[model samples]
Target: MKLRISHETTYGYDQPIRNLVQSLRLTPSIFEGQKTHDWRIEIPGGIRGPGFRDGAGDWVEGWTLRGPAEEVSVRISGHVETRDTAGVLRGHREMIHPLAYLRSTHATAPDKALREAAMSLETTGDHLELAHGLSALIAAAIAFRPGVTETHTTAAEAFALGQGVCQDHAHALITVARLRELPARYVSGYLHSTADGQAHEAAHAWAEIHVGNLGWVGFDAANRCCPDERYVRLGSGLDASDAAPIRGVAMGTGAERLAIRVQVEEMEQ
Candidate 1:
């Protein structure tokens, strides 16, 4: 399948900022499952800095804006051809060891409820089955409801609330997977909506677990399935903050407000 994506993020400030620096992970992953065709990141009047691929095999690009300006915009447009690998991440080069993901970040730390949820699942000593079971359990546990949680909502808090968006499901899944001693990380990406007419928010989030010989396999509890051709992976990290598509700092005390617009659609081949 071929997919086209357009994303724009705008930042507004009450007062002009002295300077702004941002690290972007907006490019799609280079793996067996997907191939990039045309991709570009544009920041009007911003200086582009050097970019590099990290140990986790995701491209990180830097940008700077010397601003006495009240607004900054980042726009990304791209097309990618994707194949179904049945959620298995293959041919992606990375230097990090799977065990490294076992360590929990603040956003994905397991609490009593999460730990209990992980422990209650029946396991057959089969890593693949265990992973799927966990994904299903999480999907059943949490109802997918937007506007119920914020970006900083922790996995434990979302679990207790029993409702959240994809980010919450991804964080909660990662937390529970770690509690089960499985290496897991958060995945940030875009997903084309299914034909069922279910509406989704701008971007998407999922959990990837290391299943012995399978490397990293994606599980999206929010959608109750593994990633397929509809998914375009961008990056992976211990949690959402670490894998954020855009992370930056504005050098002034000016209050900032943000607005984002994203569209992911299936394109005819």
Candidate 2:
């Protein structure tokens, strides 16, 4: 399948900022499952700086604004060809050990409820089976609803509330997977809504669990399935914040208001 994507993010401030810097992980991943084409990322009037691929094999680019700027915008557009790899991550070069993802973050940290739930699952011993079970549990536990949670909402909190978006589902799944001693990480990316007709934000997220013999496999508990051609992966990290597509800071104290628009659609062959 071929996919086209467009995304824009704008920042507004009451006061002009003296300086600003950003690191972007907005490019699509390079793996056996997906191939990118004509991808572009633009930040108007910003100076491009050092860029590199991290140990996890995700591209990171830097940008800076030197002037007193009150508004800033980022634009991303691209095309990608993807195929069904059955969720298995292959041909992706990375130096980081899988065990590194066993570390937990604030957003994915489990509480008593999460640990208990992980332990209660019938499947054990097989990492692949346990991962699928955990994903199913998360899909059943949370009803997909936007605006019910915040960016900082923890997996435990979302589990208790029983309502959240893809980010919450990914965090919750990562939490439970870690509780079961599975190496798991959060993935940030885009999703073209499927035939299921369940509307999800174009900016999406999921979890990856390291299964024996299979390496890392993606599971989107929010959609109750593994990633396929409809998905485009960007990056991975221990949590949402760490895996954020954009991360930066302003030198001056100006409260920032952010807005984002994203569209991911299937293109005809």
Largest lDDT belongs to which candidate?
1
- Lowest lDDT sum, 10 consecutive residues, model 2, at 193-202
How close is each model in CA RMSD to the real structure?
Answer: 1.0, 1.2
Clashes of each: 0, 0
lDDT of 2 at 6: 92
Summed over model 2, clashes come to 0
The segments of candidate 2 whose C-alpha lies over 4 angstroms from its true place after superposition are 198-201
1-269 in candidate 2: lDDT tens per residue? Answer: 89899999999889899988999999999999999999999999998899999999999999998769899999999899999999999999999999999998889888899989988998658889989999999999999999999999999999999999999999999999998889999999988884496654569999999999999999999989999988899999999998999999888787989999998877889
* Best-performing candidate as measured by TM-score: 1
Give residue 166's error in model 1 in angstroms. 0.3
Model 1, residue 269: C-alpha shift (Å): 1.5
TM-score of candidate 1 versus the correct structure, residues matched by position: 0.98
**Candidate 1 lDDT over residue span 96-169, tens digit each:** 99999999999997888898899998877998899999999999999999999998999999999999999999
TM-score of each: 0.98, 0.97
